[model samples]
Target: MDFEKLLVWQRAKALAVSLYKELANCGDVAFKSQITRSGLSVPSNIAEGMERFTNTEKRRFLSIAKASCGELRTQIMIGGEIGYIPALLADRWINETREISKMLSGLINRISD
Candidate 1:
């Protein structure tokens, strides 16, 4: 249950790091802040959830992380459509978020069982 050992957590962390680097040169402060915050939240929540003592607490945090995945995907899409993000890069981010969301679902279900 260690977050570091989780592939989803690792990807989420890498995504956040890449996002921060990508947004570093962005001229839109609002967009940059929103995406980066949500991106960071994914891994942060996963780690925090995995550290919880109860399944309920872990599920709650995982749910939040999943929600953040959705939020980040939306932001990435918008950024792409608006030309702030490259299409290929945005697509990659969206796909990664989707995978992370799925992973979180599996983890949540396993914890519930």
Candidate 2:
């Protein structure tokens, strides 16, 4: 299946785009870069994994994507605490990361079986 067709991938991509837009004018370059990179990694790794020929490779990439979800969630929390991200928006994004992580887990389990 194409990664683009996956709901998780689509959501992940959307979240990353939202992050970029929200942080466009952020004064702290380092924080913006770190958060955006983690957000982007979710969909990017998912796409890369789905395109791999082997299940092992696919799982590896999916696992990386799952890990990125956690990383993104952490960054989001930190961003919120540090006043970089708005409260509501940060909560929404954190929830999204959790859902995306669950979706990635499902995909990994399916591939494993």
Candidate 1 TM-score to native? 0.97
Model 2 TM-score is: 0.98
Please provide the root mean square deviation of candidate 1 (C-alpha atoms, Å): 0.8
Tens-digit lDDT track of model 1 for 1-113: 67899999999999999999988999999989999999999999999999999899999999999999999999999999999999999999999999999999999999973
- Candidate 2, residue 37: Cα displacement in angstroms equals 0.5
Worst 10 residues of 2 by lDDT: 104-113
lDDT of 2 by residue, 1-113 (tens): 98889998999999999999999999999999999999999999999999999999999999999999999999999999999999999999999999999999999999962
Candidate 2 Cα errors over 4 Å, as ranges: none
